[model samples]
Target: MNSFDSSIETYLSNLHFGHLATRSIASIADLYTFKGLVLIPVLWWMWFQHDERREWRREMVFATLFSGLAALVVGRLLTHWLPFRVRPVYNAELHLQFAGSDLNDALLSNWSSFPSDHAMLWMAVATGIFLVSRRIGVLAILYTALFICLPRAYLGFHYPTDLLVGAAVGIVIAYVMTRDAIRVRYATPALRWIERHPAPSGMLAFVLCLELVTQFDELRTLASSVVRNL
Candidate 1:
C-alpha cells in the first residue's frame, strides 16, 4: 500500500465509530436536504416577490443564487484537490465494524473528506437568501446545520468539524458576495429589468429552470425508463 493509503487508514481508525444505518435517519436527512436546501429558498423568494424594499427580485435573486452556486463549486473544487483525509469506507487497511448499506452509485461520492460540499453549497445559498431577510437567514443557518452538517456526519461522509468549516467557508463567501453595497449594486440592473417586465411568473420560470439544470442528473435518470422485452 502507498503512503497515502496508510495515512488514510490511520485517520479513519482514529475517528470514533458509530453504528451506521440507511434507515429512518437517512430518509429524514434526504427530506431536509430537499426541503431546506431546495424548496425553502425558492418559496422564500416567491413570498416576498412583491416587497419593493428587498431590492431582490427576479434577476437579483437569480444572480445571487448563481453566486452561491459559484461559491459551492469553488469549495468543492478545492476539497477535491486538497489532501485532507478519507472516509472510513475508502480507507483500505481498516476493517469497518459497522458497514451501512451502500447509498447506490447514484448517491455515491468519492470526494476527499474534510469540507463537505453539501454543507458548503446549502450554507452558501442560505447565506445569500438570508441577506434578503434575517428570519430567512437564521432559518437557513439552522437548516444547514441540521440537514446538511448533521446528516453528513451521521451518514459517515464527514467529521462534524468538516461540516463546521464547510459552513464557515460557505457563509464567508456568501457574505463577501452579498455585502450591502454589492447587493444594491447588483440588484439595480435586476430592478430595472423587472421594471420593464413586472411579472413574477417569468422570473419564477427562469429560477426553476436553473434549479432543474443543477439537478439535471436526477431529471435525466427519471426521463429514462426500465423496459421489459419479451
Candidate 2:
C-alpha cells in the first residue's frame, strides 16, 4: 500500500510546475470546490428539466441527496473509528511542496485523511445522477473525479488510494440507496411530504445544501469552538 500511494505521490510532487501556477489552482479549488456553485446548480437543472421521466428524476434527486448525506456521515464515522493517518501534505516523508495559501489547515492538524469525504459525497451524488440520466451522470462523475477528487490528491489533502476507497464506497452506497425497493419505500413518502410542506421543507433543504457546499466547515468550526468552551 505504501508503494502504491508513494508511486502516485512521487509523480504528482515531481511535476515541477511552477509553485505559482499550482497555488493559483489550489486557491481556485479551495474556493470553489466547497462552494458547490457549479455542481449543485447542475443537480438542480437535472431535477427540474422537462422530461418524460420527470417523476423518476425527482425520485433520483432525493436519492442523490440522501446518498450524499449518508456517505458524508459514514465518512465522518470512519474517520473517527479508524486509526488517524496524516494527510500527504503533512507527511514529512512525502516531501510534498504545495501552495499553502489556499489549503484550509485550521482544523486539519488532527483530522484523518484516510478516505476523502469529498470523494464519498460527490461520487455518491454523481452515482445517483447517473441513475436518472446516463449522459448527465457520466458527465457529473467525470467532473467529480477530475475537478474534485484530483485536486484533493494534488493539493496533498489525500492520496490516490484514499480517493479510490471513498469513491468505491460512495458508489456502492448510492447504488444501494437508489435501488427500486429503497426508493419506492422511502423516497416516495419523503417527496410527498416535501410537496405537502414547501416552506419548511425548502428552508431545511437550503440549510442542507449550504452545509454540503461548505463541506460542513461552519458546523465543524462551531462544534470545535463549543467543545473548547466546554
- Candidate number of the best lDDT: 2
Decoy 1 TM-score against native: 0.66
Top TM-score: which candidate number? 2
For residues 1-230, write the lDDT of model 2, one tens digit per residue.
38999888777766645767787667655775543665677667876788798877888888888888899999999999988988888887667675452465856768999898889988998888788779988988998898888877877788899999999999999999999988889889988998899999889988887777777888888998999999
Number of clashing residue pairs, candidate 1: 0
lDDT of each candidate versus the true structure: 0.59, 0.82
* Each prediction's number of clashing residue pairs: 0, 0
Which segments of model 1 are wrong by more than 4 Å?
1-21, 30-49, 56-63, 92-101, 104-109, 197-230
lDDT of 1 at 176: 74
Candidate 2: residue 61 lDDT (0-100):
86
Candidate 1: C-alpha lDDT: 0.59
Candidate 2's C-alpha runs over 4 A off are: 33-35, 98-104
